[model samples]
Target: MNATQEKHIAVVGGTFDPIHYGHINLGRAALSALHLDEVWFMPSGSNNYRSDMGIRAEKHHREAMVKMAIAGEERFAFSDWECAQPGSTYTSRTFAQLNATFPEVTWYYVVGADTLHSLKYWEEPELICNSVVLLAAGRGEQVTSGELQATAQTLRTNYGADIRFIPWEDMPVSSTQVRARYREGSFAREDLPPGVYDYMTSHHLYQSLEWLSDQEILDRCDATPEERGYYERLATMLTPRRLRHCLGVMHMAMLLADGYRNVSMEQARLAGLLHDCGRTENNALNALGHAPAGAQVARRLFGVKDESVLSAIRWHTTGRPGMTELEKVIFVADYIEPFRGHMLHLDKARRIAYTDLNQAVTFMGESTVRYLESRGEDIDPITLETVNYYRGLLKKQPIPGQYQ
Candidate 1:
């Protein structure tokens, strides 16, 4: 086969709700093994197999994410033809349409080994198998050579399918795992393409209260049923004004985290959102601080088990000495969020946040002290300790860990 003798096109189709690295690896593997000129990512609009799955995003969002995911890959392109169709999407129908459009090229369907096993059950399975050469890739620890050989032999004998198993190291990533982590407030940007991850975060996709209706919100939250219940309760518990403030804090924390590499944006957002969970009419002036109270509520009500996230929420309002990067981000974001409304030097504090995290923390702590003194309110000992500690750092001196 000369380099330009045949026009070989590989087609990788999936729901791709938020395409991860694993999907990209599979397409790359197929392209290399089959010598395909390009890989077309076909994101199905309404998959009959996945129709019962509740976590699917809308067609436009999925399509957008897919585009962002494959932006820089020269050989990768996406088609909206399947998504534009109404009703359940069948692979056979897509293959028919693709063949009609590009009759000169040889189409290879790239899929996982699991999908290969279930291909016979798809609508008009014979038509699908005969239309394109099936290129099945293995998932980590799931597909075996013996099983793959048996399945391919059966398919070839039964339906005259041109099946080939492209062997490569298995990738453990999956969209389900990504969605689960997002709901648990632990999604890492490394699991996805950088552009796709940024798009999801900036748009607040897969978060609680971002969708219409409680059920839709719960569905998109990507948490377990029990965790979803807790989110619902929290939504009702906080006043609308307070909830808006919490959201603002979350966004601010994420923005600040970009400058501080030690802190995770996801953890910062979670801490900022739950920082005021304990503030209510009953506990507005309680002797027990809202920070600690919010930590307790987060543990008991929201099932938060991450120690760093809990600690960040626990000390967001009153900064403790020797705080972690995430703690500093949440503490600063809570003070400087846009909705905080009318504070002296707030603009300076916001500017310092991106330039120097330590300075921002020190500024917020000192401002809090001065504000409390002016109002004749009691000063928290820990707040003073934090201010002094950062001041010591600014002066290049060691301060004893008195508040730890």
Candidate 2:
């Protein structure tokens, strides 16, 4: 169907916190079934009531996600009409605006099965009923198909609304489930639409304290029940983006710990997870970087009694002269975690890390020293001293049981 020749169109509106395949599928089904000339992914939500509420992503972000989700689909378009509007929005007013603005087009408002049953109770049901046709995605979990058809008939009789159901067996994904998985640090690459996960990771969309109560956070730590509060506090301290990085480091540290005899997984897990606890919006504007401050915070506020864990967190940013194996694990993991795409020597260090611990630290130190020199930046004396120590240590002998 040509856009210029179009007479029929569908508007799929919701919060679309991070539009996923389920939403894309709904639009696709609408275009195919209704022979729609165009399907607009118009995000509609009131600032008054929201599923994610205050922590719900910014409207621009929601709009960007909708735009990204519908890209390359000729019939699928993104609409910022309602989302860009100021203040609370009612569906009736929104559709009325569309009708008045583009009277040539016949509009079909797309919604889920749950919304299908509640159409009349919405503000100005007659205006909504008279303005557009209703096309509901068939989410038949809580409510049955017979119930949806019955509700559709009731709406038609009472409000003179035209409601149609698309055949959706079940909605495989929901924003709540997606947010839960993100909070747990367990969402897979396939769980979201393309670019959505990367966008979420970049923006730190769902890593909030509110996203998890959080048993999910406790489970994600892979820690004991006693350590739950520490992880919870950690979640609250860092920004959402930083919290994700911490989880990545914690997971990577655990992976690296498996290869070394001296390193304990529990110790590595705790150290990696809390390595950045001192980070905040202000710490002398990052003049007091996280490493040393983190150790102090770990001991005082979090009550981490383990000196090994404290030492690991302390020197993670600046490698020390006589660093322990666990220290190297946290340091290496922080630098080489999977989420880091911007740092130097990441792939080489990551490869060498699993093979030889001593050589990995040596590589990390030497490369950082060189990068700092090339940039004409003031090299930290401790960093130079630590690099020298690792170089000399590499010459002397390899530590026992340090090889993968």
Candidate 3:
């Protein structure tokens, strides 16, 4: 690399709630795919959500934790960008600040495969893409070139930017799973990255009362037994009808993800199984939203922090204008679950998953939009956007036949 000319810079930011191997793999992949000079591991601080939690460690403590986690990595360096910002930080702002500091360096914002799908929905997502290349890690059945092309077209048409999709097939481990295990008091040192494992053990992270909430839930679920024989028994005990809705959404969402050719079966299944866990009270469906509830459950019970999965569950019921494939999968699956009542076209929609997940998901989205329209329900912005997003793709590359 020339000394005078700036090198490519890839920024990988996360809560590091206890960074793990997956994070390291993502950082390394970004460097190779973006052809960058270095990758920065940025830790967040005092954001709107974290600030409210009152559980995030002090700035120095968190930074020290990050330092400990990345001690031996030569290619990875820590940047306190989110921590330095005065308020809740956004990706666009972070990219701009980093670019201003190193104007000559080409920038790429590294995100998981799920986050990349939902990038269009982020605040000022267009500018963020324009400012830095968007790199994604992992694969599932859901991602397809058509989907990427659709997302690219949306960015170009709406934001005047193009994003490069780097398919990453790295480790499948998730921070959320780690968190869930931690919450349940079952997480071991083996679950973390070598460096992170060392840091957690030395400092004793995730062993507090705050994280033990899920243990109580696990206890309750284990205690309860449903009367239904097998599937019913599993559904009622492992995943309830209401929870089944979330899982069905997840199952369909995974198929949708498969259509995109990026979502993995394993990741989707896990997301499906855990998506509706936050919805504790079935009767309170219209009252307390499920995402926050599910997210709380995930953090306490399941330990999910993939952000993509968390965001999917959080926004499933009231989808915003733009969502990733994973998010759409969870959202649409809830409505189209095989066991759910009052489905618009359950057979048609369900069949689409086996043939063309995109078609199925688009059908689910359109049906959902129409269903809500008929009932005068408040339509989720993202649900509409997801419909439109697919409609745009369907126009560009129509499916062969009506999904069987």
Candidate 4:
């Protein structure tokens, strides 16, 4: 093989504020599946949605930690191009740059099923897809064969793209759970890649970042008069089962927020605990039109104005028009909550949630669509539209004449 043909690389990139096991697993899986020559760990300097104002570690520190976490993985190497480059880092720009530098090499972008769903919204999305073959891992929320066929048929009639759903090994390890363990000071060596725990300890990443600690946020939420009032009022209104599920969602949200470093634990807990406050016996919660109801509850009771918190409440059930990071977190948490009994798709959501926000959003939204389908419930138009919007964003080829 020529030099250009010889180079086959899989790029597994993330913020790596606190690199953990899930990331390593994905890299290994991608490497094995693609038979790639190498997998590079590209730690983003900062995410556009998750800015430096709340970032606990500097770019150099985060990159170093990522380097240390994957130190022993022979196939893994670290790159800081995104961190070194000025301005917000984008995947299209990153891929364009890579292609420019290594025109002869074959590059396969490894992403979760969720990320694959939101390709259209990305910068130069169509161009990006044309440049490389995307390898997407299956998620918990993926539609069943019948549903997929129905949806695919609908898309085929509408758009001339073929949505190839790849079946891959599922990984349940989540960034959220890892962050929670770190916050409670209970993260074991096994929970993370070797040396990551020590790096976090030496760097004091979690302790310094108050929001990274879940217990602290829970304490803060309990201490805050507004959070307290909302909790107490909801306690009186909701049944014990609903309350327990809400608690489970909150716990999961806190874990996810901790893992991503995009939003605070306080925000996650607040949003997660309150996302379904509007859920009432009048409407089966698994039914449609619950998000707006939850939004109303947030406004009427707590008087919250922050876009992230309110958006989270509004889109937790069936997503609304536009969603923010906190909103996406709550949405994903509702679908992937630790308490879910029949979840076989945990790996898919976890894969995208940490690395890409848009992918995470699509994953949860599509999961919502699939969940309603499984129960023989009516599919809400807004939710379906939301899924379609993200599908467009991901540049996925629609199955013609179906689900349009």
Q: Please, what is the whole-model Cα lDDT of each candidate in the order they appear? A: 0.74, 0.73, 0.59, 0.66
Q: Candidate 1 — which residues are off by over 4 angstroms?
A: 1-6, 47-55, 139-144, 208-404
Which pairs clash in model 2?
Answer: none
Model 2 CA RMSD to the hidden true structure, in angstroms:
19.7
* Residue-level lDDT tens digits of model 3 in 1-404: 47679787788787777677788778877766666778888876443222111133324345566776677887888887676553346878788877888778888778876675677678888778778776656554434557756766777678766456665676767766775676577767666655555554443444431232322222211212211121232354343446445434443444344333456544555566566666554426552366667766666655566777777667666554456767666766666554466776776665554445466567877777777779987765556665666776677343222221
Q: What is the per-residue lDDT of model 2 for residues 48-95, given as tens digits with 9 covering 90 to 100?
A: 112111245545556677887788988988887775554357889998
The top-ranked prediction according to TM-score is 1
The parts of candidate 3 lying over 4 Å away from their true place are 1-3, 48-59, 140-145, 201-204, 207-404
Per-residue lDDT tens digits for candidate 4, residues 1-404, read: 46656688878777776777667776877876666888888876453223221234445456767888889788898887786653357777787788888887777777665665466667776556655656665654573445545644443344433344445556676655665678788878777777777766654554433233433333422335666667677777777667656765775676566556657768888888888888866656554466787788778866767767887887776665466668777887787664466765776665566566677777777776777678887776667766777767787653232356
- Positional deviation of 290 in candidate 2, in angstroms? 30
Q: What is residue 176's positional error in candidate 4, in angstroms? A: 3.7
List model 1 lDDT by residue over 269-352, tens digit each: 678777888886567655338889999989998878999999998888788889999999898888876567688897677767
TM-score of each: 0.50, 0.49, 0.47, 0.46
Worst 10 residues of 2 by lDDT: 46-55
Q: How close is candidate 2 to the true structure, as a TM-score?
A: 0.49
Model 1: per-residue Cα lDDT at residue 72? 88
